[model samples]
Target: MQLPILAYGHDILRKQCDEIDPSYPGLDKLIDNMWETMYGANGCGLAAPQVNVPVRLFVVDSKSTHDRMDEVIREDHFVREDTGIVETFINANILDESDDAWIDEEGCLSIPALTERVKRPWSITIEYFNRQFEKQTKTFYGTTARMIQHEYDHTEGVLYLDYLKPLTRKLLHGKLEKIAKGQIKAKYPMQFVK
Candidate 1:
């Protein structure tokens, strides 16, 4: 089933997510729904908060991103050899982030049409549980790392727009207001705060 994505201004989007254990009911089903919702929205990543669930879970399919690598490389100089990785992260924590920062324009399924250039570390070491609740610690770099970081932020009550410069944010105030008022249109189904 494809869950309705909660739009910006939803209270849940600003709340920190709770960690779920292996015994959590319907864990597999939720993950599957998230994947369906994400792919339905044509998003590369989706977090529980986006679905109005305050849980530390997210899904990422970098295949679409991989498919766009040629254009990305031409426009942003992003160089990476690995491609097409799909993974689920639960109860994730960033152990460390590289000092090297990169600026990339990012968009969120919850925020609809808004996109912003945010600066984030190029690499990160993270500890997380897989779908089976197995613990795994790994390092990710390039586009994959960027995608993970974005989704991780959602779990911590952070949005990509928060990283924009004050002036830029101010400039986008009108659009942001429209989004908050549920006046904007998104290709996918969304639930806005009343």
Candidate 2:
């Protein structure tokens, strides 16, 4: 099932998400729905808050991005050689971030049709539970890390727009307002706040 992604103005986007354990009701189903919803929206990542669920969970599939990378670049940067790996992160915490920062344009499912360049660490070490509730710690780099950081921010009640300069944000105010008002058309289904 594909869930309706909540738009930006929704309060749930700004609220910190709660952690869920294995016994949480419909854990498997909810994760499946999120994947369907995210892929439906052509998004590389999606957080629980984007679906109006205040839980520390997000799914990512960076295979397309990975496949497009130059072979040399791929071998040099990515920790995994496999392209199109789907990962589910639950109750994730960033244990460390590299001081090296890079700027990349990012888009969000909740803030449809808007993309912004934000600065973030090039690598991160995170600890989280998988879909099966097994604990794991892993470090990610390059594009994968960038995508993870974006979704991780969602679980922390932060948006990529928040990282923009005040002037940049002001410039986008009109478009954002339109999005909040449900005045813009989105390719995927969305639920705007009334």
Candidate 3:
């Protein structure tokens, strides 16, 4: 089932998520539903917090932008999944170590109807888990890496707005307030912020 996405000002989005335990009932289903919910909402990533569930679980897909898997191989680095979807990270550690820069427009599910430009590292290495509860690590650079960083931040109670410039926040403050007040409805209300 696609869960109702919580909007801005909701406390759940700001709360740090708990680690996922594989033994938990409905864990697999939750992951499936998260992806369904994410894809349905036109989002590339979705954290458990967005669904009002504070679990250290999130989904990510970043294949088109970052093709730097070769670099990690060159460094004799460890490899994980062929398809990049960091399903559940009990504790995710992200390292920013890439020079290739790119500025990208980003949107959030909580702060619906607002797309802001945020500066992010083009590449990163993330250590996390797969659906089967196995440990894994991978390096990504470009848009894919940005997606991972964005979603991981959600697990820590960080919002994209926190990273936005003051001017950007000021411009969207009124609309975001309206969104919070339900005074205006976004034509495309986001269900996943990352």
Best by lDDT: 2
> Which residue pairs in candidate 1 have backbone atoms (N, alpha carbon, C) closer than 3 angstroms, thus clashing?
none
The global C-alpha lDDT for each of the candidates, from Candidate 1 onward, is 0.88, 0.90, 0.71
Pick the winner on TM-score between candidates 2 and 3: 2
Q: Pick the candidate with the highest TM-score.
A: 1
Angstrom error of the Cα, residue 175, model 2: value is 0.6
lDDT of 2 by residue, 67-118 (tens): 7779887765466644645799999999999999888779898898889888
Tens digits of lDDT, candidate 1, 1-194: 99999988888998999999999988889999999999999999999999988999999887677777677483343345556569999999999999999988899988888888889998889999998888999888777889999999999999988888899999999987788788998999899877
Candidate 3, 1-194: lDDT as tens digits: 77667777777788888886679779888888888887677677888888888888888865422244565542322224333444545457675557766677788766667888887776788887778888778787655677777888899999888887798789888887777776655444434322
Query: What's the ranking of the predictions by lDDT, best on top?
Result: 2, 1, 3
TM-score of each: 0.94, 0.93, 0.80
lDDT, model 2, position 172: 96
Clashes of 2: 1
| Candidate 3 residue 94 C-alpha distance from true site, Å | 1.2
